[model samples]
Target: MQRIFITGTAGFIGFHLARLLLDEGFTVAGFDGMTDYYDVRLKQRRHQMLLQSPGFRATEAILEDRDALDGAIDAFAPDVIIHLAAQAGVRYSLENPRAYIDANVVGSFNVMEAARRQGVAHLMMASTSSVYGAETAMPYVETQKADTQMTIYAATKKATESMGHAYAHLYDLPTTMFRFFTVYGPWGRPDMALYKFVDAILDGRPIDIYNHGEMYRDFTYVGDLVRGIRLLMDAVPVRPADPADIAPGDSLSPVAPHRVVNIGNSTSVRLLDFVEAIEEVLGVKAQRNLMAMQPGDVPATWADASLLQSLTGYRPQTDLRDGVQRFVDWYRAYKDSGGLR
Candidate 1:
């Protein structure tokens, strides 16, 4: 069995991805800080579920602690490393810019150093659609220029991409950066819109609808997003022999074994339509609190995942209504079990 070291197994994406990989018969070593960004109970619950699998082992520690991170990675000595832990919230970054710099910048450097030392076959890290800041083009593609990141969170992720490219170029490390769209489904983050919308609607409270419910998002389901990551794990980039050898539409760097891929549903759904799906699933009309867009938030986002498809031969096809229903079902069950009140 191939051994894999994954950071942030307690996080929403990391939890789901670890489970999927474990089911596929991979040995996974998870690292997480279990921070109280949302609810530590929720994070603990995710880790507990993963522990049921004998293939899963975890260390509870923050990424900023280089010793802890290096210790875990050295002991595991994984064949591949997936760095997913980061201070993740666009709006929160506006409040605490230093947090992003610490976790995303400094902590990421630690991961890269570990990967370089371990000489892992591949290193995959998470980026976000937010990196496509200030771009109004339809269906954002991987090869597009994305320098204008409006939020600290997006800027930090962009910085990581640059850092990863430099490391790959220097060390010949095969690195892949996945630019994820708005992901949703069971075990989603509490700070996300879907979670907040469901919580407030079910409680008969007003739900905040930013951008007056006019925003558009390529809300890739959590399952689909993780599946994309799994497939891309095998689609590792290699340093191109020549700049012209890189395929058209490919984001591969000519000088390094590095590339950026967008994992998304590829279909943009209106914010109101998404809420309607939730309302329909819950059978409750939400008290809408329409408001102006939040700072550092884009009015719309869409992903052109053609590169992902050409590489992995898979695309995210989960319907918004179906995904919403699944989340609502999970939310209700979780609440009934006293996981949340």
Candidate 2:
């Protein structure tokens, strides 16, 4: 069985990914800081469930703690390392810019260093579509120049991408940076729009519709996103003998065994349309508070997942309505169990 070390195993994406891997008989060691960003109970609930798996073991520590991080990695000695833990919120980045620098930038550096020392076969980390800030292109591609970052959150994630490239070039570590679109599903983060909207609607509170509900997003379901990640794990990139050998849309670096892939639903859905699906799922009407665009937020995000499909022979195809319904069901159960508090 493959041994994998994953950061943020207590997080929304990490929890789901770990579950999938464990179900496949892979041994997973998880690391998480358990920050009080949202609800610590929620994070704990996730970890508690993962602990049920005999193959799952975890270390509770912040990514900023170099000693703890290095120690855990060395102990696990995993064949693959997936770094998914970060202070993740676009608007919150405005309130606490330092958090992003500490978690996304500094934390990611520590992981890269550990990967270098361990000589891991592959190092995969999470990047975001927010990195494609200020670009109005419909279906953002991996090869596009993503230099204009709107917020400190995006800037930090973009910084990680650069750092990963440099480490791959220097150490010959096979690295893959995933540019995830707006990911949502069951066990979603409370700070995310879907979770907030669902909770507020259920509680008879007004839901804030940013950008006057005109925004668009390529809301990739968590299941599809993780599946894309699983496939990419096997499709490791290699430094091409010649740059011309790479495909037209490939983002493979000519100087290193590094590449950036976009994982998202190819279709972009309007914000209002998404909310409508949520309302339909829960059988409740949301009191909408149309608000102006918040700082450090984009009006829309669409992903060109062609590279991901070409590499993995799979694409994220879950319909928004079906995915929202699943989340609503899970939310009801969680709320009834007093897990939402």
Candidate 3:
């Protein structure tokens, strides 16, 4: 059986990815900090579910805790390593910039070190479309100027892409960094837009609408997001034979086995339409407290996912309404399970 070592297994994306791996008969070794950035109970619940699968084994440690992570990887001896843990959130980074450095910057460096030491077949990690920064580009392609990052979180993620590339060059580690665009669905992070909107709408509270409801996002469902990741696990890059063949904005290190791919729905939906999806599911109109754009926030993010299809023959296909309804169903069940007191 192929073995996979994944970080952030307790987080939303990690939990989903780990479950998918387990079902596919891959023996998964999971590591997670289980930070109380959101609800510890939710993270715990996700972990609880994964434990029921016999092939899944978990070790807990902070990614920045290099020594602990090293020990865990040594024990797991995985064929592949997926680094998904990071201090996530653009606004949160502004509130606590040091957290980004500790978790994202130092943390990712630790993951790269582990992957290099293990000499894994491939190392994959999650990046955000926020790295696109303030580019007025309509659809973000793999080969585009991403040097301009607006938020500390985006900057750190962009930094990791560079760091991963460097590691790939130095150690010949095959690496793929996926830039995800607004991933959403059931079991999503509570701090994300969909969850917060669902909770507020259900509780009859006002939901914050950024950019005065003028924002646009390539809202990809979590299942499609995970499938794209699974396909990418096998799309490892070979170091380029010639630097001149590297396309523009490809984020390919001429000397390394590294490339960046955009995994998104490839369709940008208006913010009001997303809110309407939630309202439609809940049968209630949100008390929209429309406001100005927040600092370090972008007005729109769209992905050019043709590269993902070309590489993996996959594209994220979940529609907003269907995805939102699934989330609502999960939310109701989660509440019924005594999530809310």
Candidate 4:
């Protein structure tokens, strides 16, 4: 079995990815900060479950601590290094910009440096659709300019893409950055839309409908998101000879063995319709407290995932209703157990 070093194994996406890898017979060395960014018990539960598999080993440490992080990477000597740990929330970033800088920016540097030293075959990191802020084009493509980031969280994630490029250029380390588009599903984060909506609807509380219920998102499920990452791990980019030869809409750098691909459902789901799906699953109606869009939030986001399909031969196929139902099932079980809300 191949050894994989995954940062943030305790996080939402990381938890799902680590479980998938372990089930596939890969030995995973999980590094997590176990930060209070969310419920630490939930993170602990994720780790606890993973520990049941003999192939999984976990290390608890913050990504910003370069020395400890480097030690863990060297100790594990993984075949691939996946950096998914970060201060993950668009709204939270507005309240605490420093967290993004510390976690997303500085923390990413430590992961890349370790990957460079270990000479890992593949290095994959998380980018976000928020990086595509303010782009009016339908179906945000991989080749679009992502400089106009609306939130500090997005700006930092976009920075990691650049950071990975420079390292790949310098060391020829194969790197792929995946931009997520509103990922939602089982084992999802509490701060995400699906979780919040589910909680409010089930509790008979009013759900906050941002953008006054006019927003649209390309809601990709967590299972689909992790599968895309797994496929991309094997689809590492090779440095091209001429920058001009780079394919149109390709986020590949001219002189680096690095590329950025959007991982999302190609279809966009409106916020109100998304709420309806949750209600259907819970068999309850939500009291909508419609509100204007928040600062640094865009009205909509959609992804053109053809590049992902061409490279991975797969696309996120889970329908919105099905995904929402799966999430509700998980949520209800957790609520019943008093383990999740």
Candidate 2 has a TM-score of 0.99
Tell me the tens digit of each residue's lDDT in model 2 across 1-341. 29999999999999999999999999999999999998999999999999999999999999999999999999999999999999999989999999999999999999999999999999999999999999998789999999999999999999999999999999899999999999999999999999999999999999999989999999999999999988999988898889989889999999999999999999899999999999898889999999999988899999999999999999999999999988888998998989942
* Model 3: ten consecutive residues of lowest lDDT: 245-254
Error (Å) of candidate 4 at residue 175 is 0.8
List per-prediction Cα lDDT, in the order shown. Answer: 0.94, 0.95, 0.91, 0.90
TM-score of each: 0.99, 0.99, 0.97, 0.97
Off by over 4 Å in 2: none
Best by lDDT: 2
lDDT of 3 by residue, 133-227 (tens): 98987799878888889999999999999899889989999999999999998888899999999999889999999989999999999999999
Model 2 pairs whose backbones collide: none
What does candidate 4's lDDT look like per residue over 96-117, in tens digits? 9999999999999999999988
lDDT of 1 by residue, 86-170 (tens): 9999999989999999999999999999999999999999999999999988789988889899999999999999999999999
